[model samples]
Target: MGKGGEDYGKSEKVGFEFRDKIFPAWAKDVKECEENFQVSHEVGLSTSEVQKRLGIHGYNELEKHEGVSTLKLILDQFSDTLVRILLAAAIVSFVLAWLDGQEGGEMEITAFVEPLVIFLILIVNAIVGIWQESNAEKALEALKEIQSEHATVLRDGRKVRNLPAKELVPGDIVELRVGDKVPADMRVLSLVSSTLRVEQGSLTGESEAVSKTVRAVPEDTDIQGKKCMVFAGTTVVNGSCVCLVTQTGMKTEIGMVHSQIHEASQNEEDTPLKKKLNQFGELLTMIIGVVCALVWIINVKYFLTWEYVDGWPENFKFSFEKCTYYFEIAVALAVAAIPEGLPAVITTCLALGTRKMAQKNAIVRKLPSVETLGCTTVICSDKTGTLTTNQMAVSKLVAMGLRPGTLRSFNVEGTTYNPFDGKIEDWPVGQMDSNLQMIGKIAAVCNDAEVEKSENHYVASGMPTEAALKVLVEKMGFPGGVNSQSSSDHESILRIFPHPWISFYFSCIFFYKP
Candidate 1:
């Protein structure tokens, strides 16, 4: 159904190119998508069909262009204009020293010493730059390792198999559930529950989870407004849904953004500090060249004038040997004026600053960024996760049966998602209060969230809001916590119904367990 022939491999031979084609499934309804892709939403594609599609469309994975090559990175360190100028100066000094030796004259030790020191400085600078960039690249690779590795897909029209996310191809039906990270960009086809909510904070920077439905949205709707599409890299917060794979790898929304980021980073310009330093180096080189030229000219002119005088001193004759000596002195002065230790000092300072930042949990990718920090005056930042903790916690709770003007509210105290550390106070009511007990039971039983210990603290595996409500119920010293015997035995949660059309209410049904 994807291409022309039933065999996906043969379809490619028949010249069916689907790579460049765009499938705007977000704009189309489920029925239309089924017709367009020639797939049945119920049973999904058969094994043969899936294999064929896989052959036509490659695996779904973001292209991680290999980290900058070690050799290339090391070479790049010498590419700076300042570094190149220093290298040129070193080469000239070495050549002059060699010429002196060739002329049967004892080579001045200083001539060789200056070039050797310059060469050593260049080598150290290259090594430090290479080491920093290599570490930064490795850190990026580690981050990629944290992405979803496996996904659930419907195959052979009946079996749901867990396969590597990278093996997913277009038109495949992917099943998503709570705590599952979406492996690829997909269009919502059918929902197993009343609604599905996804935490798209990674993609949209939204603190709240977004509700998704099978209803097709207008074509003009932005990515954040799309109700029927679930993109790659987002996590499912609640409910379960079957989605049709529409795009993969660089074709997906998040992948496109990653590509843009890579492109921008590759074309990143020099920082202000680096630019100023480069300008300074160039200006200094010019001034040093002028000074060295003047020294040689003045020495040669004085020697030539004295050589023409009838009784000129023998030691002051402007001969080839004397000319060589004058040139060597000028060369040594030029080398001295040029600060060979400046680059090494700057590199060391940047390295020290980077280490300090690492201790504070900040990674500096480039050395110049360390200097940029000193010149920074203001920092504009996002408030959601940066200024505040990106976790939901219950702040206050009120009993619905409380009389008007009664001080019946309880204050809830906690930070982050850990429920064990919460404290509830200012409650005049006892635990046996019927209304308070009912609300606690409702909050606990009518939710689908779970909490588990992760390393040092407890972490939620579902919606943070639901986890907060469950935590609140626990803080009240409810018997057996959220999963208490009384609630589990009497009340069974049917389904969570998301009401995005309304402002702040989500409905859930609870049935009496016989």
Candidate 2:
């Protein structure tokens, strides 16, 4: 309970606006989050200050790659390796057939040597491919473990002592120190002259640690521009501070950077060469077929050497001519058009792409998603979690007016730390502006939330935000915001109002702002 005896004038607790920013109220087994998650609250900080303290988040527990990469999957579907061997064997068979077609001729050494050489080359290529795949597997096995084992945060409304790191979510506040890589992204809710310098070389290509500060920066500032904010995967080089956790894992700014790298690796160059290769095969087949038919037809119609009186050997020679040129042309066409080895090269390219993607923390499950990433035209983004900090802080407050003697002067305010940066000149004027007084009274008198007077300052219990609302009412000049429920000022719900119950199993106060 580090905050148990801290300031009561104002508090550091805040809220953010995010779609998936769970309140940790409705989540099942929320206590598990306390054991594993680490979101801390400092006594006094703005939401922007909280944002500066927290760091970017990503997969604390890396999801297992359920399937092989898309390239591996796609290449696995190809029959090119089989076809290469088949085509090579066919070439050898064609050469042997040509030699057999020769009359009274022995098998030439050229025919045997050529086919044998091609077979050995194909074998060597297959061996080289296997070696590359084995090397890639080894590299994959050595990759960094992305999932976390434990987290550190607060439990049962107390200071961040310690917990695990993996259970972090958007709302959890985590305390960090020097040399500790921030477990999650957070806003600096409380820092006591703490100079935290973190290395951003991996994310920003910068070599030095960016200085941490609590200040408003221009919106156009680059990722490297926000001097106060710390990101994930960045190591803290110096100092310590209490950070109010903002976003965790995959929802962090650095996580978005990781996603971009993943998307880039997913997009690949077009496969125009492959498509053209297929079309060329079809064209070559047509050409070969036409040429072979014409050669056969000409021999049958005009090249037949038949005569009435002829010797047996000469009669055989007079038989219709075999088209030697057509046979050679057909082999040449098959060799040129059907790049029987091309599929293997394309498969190699795909494997290389898969390896590149692994380097970027993207495990490609769907083969076509790679192509789709390259071809994608639009991306749908959620503003709550993706765009906005979802980190809520009381940046500005306007007082309608203040009433003096109407409020029962409370002494607990003296113990709380002063919050006004630019000190106000005066206290409440004696009953000024009736409407403002009514708003202040209604806000304080409403029941549900409470603040306790501990050793020195009033510490809020239940919702930090609700506690902050009561602080607001008090600041605007509503003393104690309660009549009292006990003597000795030892124990009583400070903001008790005997109004109709709004709802049961619900924790809230009606502001009646309208």
Candidate 3:
């Protein structure tokens, strides 16, 4: 919306669009990106300029549509074709009963029983639908609340810690460290360590962390191939990096995904079950129409009056009142053919399914969605963050002995990041094998990952492989259990080579005490 404004002509605009063309940040180097966004590595956007950009770019978050309204939910329950047909039949029957009673000059309360029962069934179905859907909406809203609330940004030559992430705008310099979530899409300016990797499993479905580079990439690179960029909603795993914010809010990659999901949801296709039900409803309506017409035509003979003179074609007279009387019977027959309880039965079954899924932490926004999922035969899904926990755990540990033929193998317990939960081979681990202890000590010393206890659980930061090693050392009860400050006792770094690409290994040479 801010495009074509006074800032449209400014060369320092942060968006990818420039008039009628697109200028990608990943295709430009640090100097060009700095000039284009008016950002710097040392002194970031000033407070006043940041405020002005915030007013233009809006918050650094995806747009969330309002939840389903109560009225809409209620109306949606009656949107089925069969339900609409039944509703019409009920109204007509009620009107006919009232007219009959008025013409007879008497109150006929019991004559309205059929229509009242149909209306009651419809109301019950609507209530069940609204209740289940509303609960699902609330559950989804709760899940959306889990997000990064603050960010660290460089402003006016000083580091501002704990700045609200939503206030972050384009052109701001963001400093990302281990375990910190990226606040917006940014172009990497510099990496503080030899390996700066971002955990993009949530964004790109990559199980392993992606190594980032400061070099510019091709403009047409796909999202997964853009090695020079980090997107919002991803976390820094291994090393620190200074990046320039290029896009925020709905302009970011995650924001775009969110928009696509919202758009797709609006035009969702009918599921197999829904389509079948609709077809059956149409067929049933047609059959009922033909049957009712046949009943009226066959019963028309009862409406004819007989004359004293008998002839081939002039012996009978048509009576309009008698003919209309038999029409009520046809209407009754049509109402009887309607399946008034089908909707209620279907809704109740779906609600039960919704309850079972909710117990497993799944929410179904619509009752029909339950059937839609049941209709799935094979699902192609990203396994990294969806099917797996995305955390590395040490399941087995083996160490070579002093002799070539001598070897000791041990099974490490626990599949989570918690170091103290499980022991080696279900043993106490208090008296670990000497070889295992030595290997654990080496793993604890040479690793760069950090594990800390947060509240009730342990949180790992850095490469998952290194984190797993750190957890193993701590699980073996190494001295000074692994933490962020764990380092070599008496060693000096001589050389280090972090090959995180093809080899997926980190080689380091250290001089350590015996």
The alpha-carbon lDDT assigned to residue 145 of candidate 3 equals: 36
What C-alpha lDDT values do all the predictions have? 0.76, 0.46, 0.78
Root-mean-square deviation of each candidate, in angstroms?
7.2, 21.8, 6.4
Superposed model 2: Cα runs more than 4 Å off: 1-151, 157-164, 218-220, 270-514
Please write out the lDDT profile of model 3 over residues 1-514, one tens digit for every residue. 1121212213343345423344578888999988888777899999999888888778887677887789999898887879888898899888888877887899677999999999999999999989988887777555233346788899999999999888988889988887788888889999877778888877778888898999987765667777889887788877788999887877776665665556666787777777888888888889888988998999877898666645445567787667767777888888889988888888889999999988766878788889999878899888886788778888887678558888666788888788877887754456666676667667876666778898888888777888899888777775566432334556766755567665756766887665
Stretches > 4 Å off in candidate 3: 1-14, 17-21, 89-120, 135-147, 293-332, 348-365, 370-382, 386-389, 399-408, 412-424, 433-461, 467-514
Which pairs clash in model 3?
A: none
Span of 10 residues, lowest total lDDT, candidate 1: 1-10
Q: TM-scores across all candidates? A: 0.74, 0.42, 0.76
Candidate 3 TM-score versus the reference? 0.76
Error of 1 at 155 (Å): 1.6
Task: Encode model 1's per-residue lDDT on 442-507: one tens digit a residue.
Answer: 788777777777887777767887888878877777767777778888877677786656865677
Report backbone clashes per prediction.
0, 39, 0
Point to the candidate with the largest TM-score.
Answer: 3
**Cα distance off (Å), candidate 2, residue 339:** 9.0
Candidate 3, poorest ten consecutive residues by summed lDDT: 1-10
Which of 2 and 3 is ahead in lDDT?
Answer: 3
The true-versus-predicted C-alpha distance at residue 505 of model 1, in Å, is: 6.3
After best superposition, candidate 3 residue 257: deviation in angstroms? 0.9
